[model samples]
Target: MLKKIRWMAVVLLTGLVMYPLPLMADHQGAGQNSTLVLEPTVVTAGRIKEKKSDITTNVTIYTREDLEASSIQDLSDLMLKEGFMVREYPNSTISVAIRGFSTDTHGNDLSSSVLILVNGRRAGTGNLAKISMDNVERVEIIRGPASVQYGASALGGVINVITRKGKGPFTASLEGTLGSWDYKKGTVSMSGAVSQFDFDVTGSKSSQGDYDTGSGSEYRNTGFDSKERFSFNGGFTFLPQNRVGISYSDYSGDHIGSPDYLSANDPDDYVNHGIKSYDVYYDGQTRDDFLFWNIRYFKGKDEYETHDGAMTPSRTYWRDTDSQGAQAQITAKWAVAQITAGWDWVDYEVSNSNTVAGKENTYENPAGFFMVKTKLLEDKLVLTGGGRYDEYEVTSDTGKVKEDDNWSFSCGAVYKITGELSVRANYAQAFKMPTADQLFMLTDYSAWGMGIWSGNENLKPESSETYEAGIDYTRGSLTGSLTYFHTDFEDRIAYKSIGGGVTQYTNVQGGTLDGVEGSLQLDIGAMFGWDWEIVPYGSFTTFLEYEDDETNEKFQYTPEWSAAYGMRVNHVEYGLNARLNFTHYGRHEITDYEGTGATTLGPDTVADFSVGKELFDMNKFGKIRLKGEINNLFDRDYALVQGYPSPGRTFYLGLNYTY
Candidate 1:
């Protein structure tokens, strides 16, 4: 491990040394300004709009243009292709890991250490596949503890999806696509502003048959019958400084085949899932622009059903989850300081039904939080601090109740070394409450000599304290960042198998995780004053240490290293755009389902390329374009998860029209 770490560090240093620094001569006669441009703005880092360069945390943003240039079908696809640490199954189940901490793809929203938000509210589902990207304007990801801004389930990080809003003149678009494995997709969207009212709406549907592996063999039951989505965002501005808006989204997947692992192929298992969410909000500011405030209320539902037709009598299991929440916040701005305070309340109810008796559980939480940001030294040094307190209650149908409370805090600072460079460090404390299933579970198996499986109401919430430091550099045609982080985790909840065939949940000593993450990008065309824009980028993560304290064993499913490299091209004169990227995952350990011990999985790499070109434009009518994509260019046979193999080489062609 030490040797590997040293080798990676040496390689990174060599690359940095070989890259040329920005040249003043390149900009002097190019008719371009030499001044640095303001970095992109983000809201998830501070719970308010702020320049990315000013934030004391690590953040990644993906704009609509970036999405359009990719061949991804959904959030899961995007994350996997972008080299984010994730485990995806053939049935569309995906789990994301950040800094060695992960979310549960099959668990409820509240159970995950990572949080997913839509427009700054809970998405109500942990499955990324259920979140459609068709109506997203952008995505903001904060890669560290965020409990001070959001409440629980933000121990690892946060992913916020910001939907599109209407602006400019009325416009509409229609798109259709065809791909391998009998895949078909169609979409329609309209957006515009009329007087004080603005709106954006979109609808899409897609279907696919089973896909083949790299060996040209069919991976039976690895496709979905159909998937449908609809989303709308609209608002009315009653005053110049105030607006009332509403948003709605719906997603459904019908007959999604769930194939067993390659070792245990079961062809008669499948699942159906659906998710719906809606929210209403009012945003306003004082006439002087010194005070800004927002209030919102949201509700959502998630349904999941699975069928096991291979059983003698066949069995079906179903779960329904309902969630509702409200949030209000106010911010006051001054010359060199800003303050924000907020309150939040939410409730979740889940019910399960199957061949056995039905069961129901409820969880409720309320919280208050505050944050302050101050600048000094001629705005070259920025400081931020925040804290939150939450009280929660849980109830089960078996007349059991559990209550708990927690507090989180964070502090950070950023210091500008130069106009184009900065350094930052942060410390944050986060926690995740015990889930209802872990606190109130009760099952009897003594008749079969399995004794009892029970939960412990005394279990405490898991907690972590993280420290991170990083540097950011942004010069003409060049951008880069590097960060190092360490986390101390404690009181992790796990099930223990005691003697007498008894199993019970309890809090156990946790572990530590340390890693380094970095990214670099440069635009060759802009640097040399060429006619076209050409950019090359690369990013990677290397784990220094990740292990459990109790057994001194490394965590499962976390690779020692992962990387992504790509290049993008654009020619505005010809209305042409292209992208080629490769994502690589290093060797990792995976749990052996067929045995009690663990097993190691080999490394794998996947490549994708996409290109689009404008065909023609008819005045008063619309513009037409054609796009093509090839995924798995090398046709590599690999599995992200132990048993679920990813599809092989695939091709797609699409036609789009806009007015």
Candidate 2:
């Protein structure tokens, strides 16, 4: 793999030298430059943002053009692309394993290594709440442990979604989609100024029929998700040295019918799963030449209720979870160097999950950090360094564990050889804290009759350091990048079996991961009055052998090879868009461990498609649009999850109107 990557790099550099291309063709291309949302996320932030020309720790930026051209609805759409491991559940819910950490299963508690963020705010996971993309401006995927700054859930990486900021003329955009299998969706958005205040409101609702398992069997899928989002911003430019602005957003949604367990042949009896969430956030910013700071606070609550008909005791399980956090950050630039510092605090509470008694659970953690970024070597080389410290206390039914602390730091530098060639490298430390289940979810399934396997009150924290580097070169008509990364996890958290079916949560020493991936973009130039492009990409990851130290048996649900690839087509006017997505997975080992006799999971492939358009442009007074999308385009039968097969040939259509 290393040799192959080297060859690709040589070819890329030689090609660039042979024929020069626009350094920012995507940026200078007609019809796209005016799109502020498409601008590099660093538009305002002083940080020297990552560009396609340099790779440091795997990161992918999906532009507004890519989103619109590909007709993507959510993260699930990324499944069609290689490198991303997406385990599809009924409906649109999917657990993504970007860069191999995903174990080819519907991501459950600790099943994924990625963190999903919306507008720099913490988004809850674990069947509680999910991040939506209706008003998303762009998505930033940082592919590695971000625990140094993100915390427990950010084991793999971070997905930062920038929301659409209110700007530009008083314009409105609307769209409608309608297609197969009782699929329908409606969307409406309007933005403009009323007096000195500017406001933007965008909302959408969608529903669809239960999808098939591609084997002609239905998984009892009949689930729908809906969200209502609104934002208001007020700002004023008071001369060359002053500016202030404030913004607020609120979102709420629901996803019904997610079960704890469903058998291959008995998918009918396992029904009744639901999740609802609400979020409210407010932020304000003030800036000057020498200094600036942004302050924000977010509050989120999630309610999850499910009647797993097959639950051991037929429990109508319910859990209520909420999080509140505040952040204050300041950035300053002085003599070719920019310094950023910030502090964050968050609290978590969970109310009952398995008992109708409504028991409440809670935990609190606080963190602080500072970073310095500088432009060196005549502003062509960039270097950054930062460190973070976290302290938290977890209190549960068992008892209280206190005095826990974690530390992480990172440094990186990028060198531009020319306007078109750049090279970069980075290193970061990330980790995850113990969850409630690990600390206290006890079980009596053992003949020992409710024996206890207590939490490690004095347990040391799990830690990891990642090293990554890459070079990117692009010339006219062709663009390409290569990225390579390696991670070493020390004292990783794990559940070690004690005896008689009971297990204890503890940290294990020695875990390693290595990966290499990249993507290529080619613009065939205007063909027949149409600007066209073809993007091809792939990723590969190797999870070193992991086993129980005591028994020396392999861990469950870890696949040796995880890889993905796809193509997209777009036409600006006339409103046409489409994609051919292919997903392939190698074999994996399942739980129910019995030495090397574990069950084999997937090593399969499947394809899917979608398209949409604006019906009429009758101005902001009113407008309508139509769309159609289908999953499992080829209807190939396959299963990414153990008995639960995926949906086949799913179709949807939606309509939107605005006034």
Candidate 3:
């Protein structure tokens, strides 16, 4: 099956690449100054609004248009479709890998190497599948270390989810969908602006039953009972240059199946999870436009409960985490330079129940950071430098305390060679503090004939330094970029088996990673001066090397290559839109749990297609659209993880009403 899919993938990719070659020459100068081209702006790169072409780091942006054209339901699905390495289990657990570093899919925010943010603040959880896309306006991704801009847990990269804001006049939307495996979903949203006030609100509910594999076999306990989500963003403008706003978001999943592996399937095991967040913020600028300032305070909570009916007594385990933080920043602008300074504070408290020894821990972090940017030579050359200092404190209910401090720094430069091309280089340092479980926990499971686990109080923080360079070009109906990066990591923390049935956490020599990322897109209709729109796009990542110094092994789930390519068509006059996308993943090594060697998986391709058509318009009432989608078009049998197989071909149909 794998071999067959590989052959089909090669043929499909070759045809896509060759189809656009013949028309390239004829459309070179057709739309040189077309208004269809617009540069994207990002805030995750420098903690301030800046055009992608002017930033010194690699970044990726996905606008609302991109989201509306796909069948994505959450962040994990979007990342996988965009050529990033992702690990998805049959039980709906998901995590992302950037470069060679990855997030902890089973851990909290503080334990992850990659940071997830909502409107520029901590999201409180590492599991990407829990984050809904109902109210997301745009997504910004920084592909390299951002420790100098953000604080800890940013050793790999950063992902910021920007929510929608109300504007113009009052409007509302309603949508419903049904798919394979008894899947069903419904959503409602509204937005409006009145005088100086604006607001947006959304709510959704979804559920599904067991799903089948590509081979037509049912995968038991691979579905969830139900999931619910809500989001809101509103604000009032005053004094012309200042605004205050409030934001709230909530997510809950009940009776989510947790079948670990096909070989060890447990039909009666499940989990319940919930997350809630609230924020209040204010932003303003002086009338002279010389100084700009913003401040925000946020609070959130995450809760999980697992029920194990496979056990004799039907055991239950639970964990509850609470988090709160505050952020304040100010930027001073000058003729040739701009300086930004900020302070951040955050605290996390975690408690566990139904354990042999109930436990509780708390973590606190305070930091100050600053950045300076200067433009030279008629604004053709841009230089930026920044640094951050952080202090961390950890405490346990057992009367154990630990304290640590660290500093991070970064520098970068961008030079525009022409009106449509630019070159950039950057160097940055990042770090991650030890988690509470790794620093203060000790469990003696020897009485149950299991290995004992102990934490190390003297473990140093894990750190890494990265160097990267890239080139970006944008002109007319074409846009593209290519970047190469290298990272050296140190003081990696890993558990090692000592004598007897015992394991202990310790710092080990780290590893090195090197990779290249590239993307390209072209609007065929705009380039040919046509009345309709047709675009072809592709993005890919290739790993040159990924090695561990201690074990001389490549990281698991780090694919050697991955790519996403497709085409889109839109005709406004006809009220029609369509899209076709293909996602391919290359083979990589994985740990062999049953043996001492490594195993391999992947080199699979999956295709998805969606289309929508406007049915009618009722003038002042609203418009109605019919939409449909098919995922895993070919039904190729594949598994992202060794024991968990992905779903087979699935179909969905929906209707959207706007007013």
Model 1 vs truth, CA RMSD: 2.2
Give candidate 1's error at residue 390 in angstroms.
0.5
Model 1 lDDT per residue over 13-65, tens place: 84466346456425542565333555689999888889898899889999999
Which number leads on lDDT? Answer: 1
User: For candidate 3, what is the lDDT?
Assistant: 0.86
Q: What TM-score goes with each of the models?
A: 0.96, 0.82, 0.94
Question: How many times do residue backbones clash in model 3?
Answer: 0
lDDT of 2 by residue, 526-619 (tens): 2112355444344444444444444465544556555555666666665566666666676766763224343887777666665657677676
The CA lDDT of each predicted structure is 0.87, 0.58, 0.86
All-Cα superposition RMSD per candidate: 2.2, 5.0, 3.8
Which of candidates 1 and 3 is the stronger one according to lDDT?
A: 1
Q: Is candidate 2 or candidate 3 better by lDDT?
A: 3
Candidate 3 structure quality by residue, lDDT tens digits, 1-659: 46434644554454456445435624654545345445679989988887787799899999998888766789998998887888897666788877877777676888888889999998998889888899999999999899998888888899899999898999999999999999999999999999999999999999999888899877889889999999999999997879899999999998888877766777879888889999999989999999999899999999887888677655467888899999999999998999999999999988886223566688999999999999999999999999999999998758689999999999999999998779999999999999887998787877777678888999999999999999887665666777889999899999899877878899999998887777877777866767678989988877777888788899777888888999989988888999888998999988775353548888998988899899999879999999899889899888778878788998999899999
**Clashing residue pairs in candidate 1 (N, C-alpha, C atoms within 3 angstroms):** none
Q: Which ten residues in a row have the lowest lDDT in candidate 1?
A: 25-34
